[model samples]
Target: MNGHQIGEKVAVKVGTDMDEYSKPVELEGILKSKGDLLGYLNATNDKVGEVCTLSIGNLDVIIANRGDSFITINHFTRAGVEIEDYDVIVVKQGYLFDELSAISKLDILAMTPGSTYQRIENIDYKNIPRPIFPMELA
Candidate 1:
């Protein structure tokens, strides 16, 4: 199966051809914070540069580096609400630019109704257990 389908379940090839399955998951959360977009102007900060942080459910995901035409969803695991990169199983899909235009234009300020950036450092996914398919920290 292709990675784009919203609820499609598929087996993802992990390191050294070990197969692990993950479903295409989507959560409607807010754009919590947007880092300095200009940081990407220099090639040196390419992949490490973060463009936006999305609050999906109780999880905060960092969408790094702007100027790309698609949004990549990756499989991941949480260690007490902290997201660990090794858990990322696959790039579910690359959302097309036009398709995400409206979402991209979202009012980021709305995410921080009262608090500041320092107060909202990470997504609270602690309730979710590790090594489970289709489940994130609660």
Candidate 2:
């Protein structure tokens, strides 16, 4: 329980796989990824209009759209969802934090442990034979 209520509705910008969008295909006379059938029915399982369930804390967030360019804040506004309506919005892109901060009062930067972006000084590199640069000073 990370302090989130059971039925809280918060906006979030989460990461999803884009492998299907990168595949080669043709649709409506134009050659593009098969996922381009955004407004069309009976498309792939991950079509734009499709919805997915994302469980965060104790709450379940419904992802209404999936596309290549939805990471931008403008997309959310265009989709009729106001950013200020939610208590917390979790975004994965670090660059987006700057833009979202203009609307929200507080912004936090959190990185997963053991990820590539984690602090190098905190890692115990037992295999390395030589001392590294700033890691040694830290």
Best by TM-score: 2
Model 2 lDDT, residue 112, Cα: 43
Output the number of the lDDT-best candidate: 2
Q: lDDT tens digits, residues 14-121, model 1?
A: 122222222234444555544433221233333433344455555555444323322222111111122332233222232223323333434122233111222333
Worst 10 residues of 1 by lDDT: 72-81
Tell me the tens digit of each residue's lDDT in model 2 across 1-138.
123333344344543333342343321111111112133222332335533334455433434445333344554444444556678876543334334567767767676432233555655577775557665543
Mind sharing the TM-score for model 2?
A: 0.37
Query: TM-score, each model?
Result: 0.22, 0.37
Clashing pairs in 2: none
lDDT over C-alpha atoms for residue 70 of model 1: 24
Q: Which residue pairs in model 1 clash with each other? A: 127-138, 128-137, 128-138
What are the clash counts of all predictions, listed in order? Answer: 3, 0
Candidate 2 has its poorest 10 consecutive residues by lDDT at 26-35
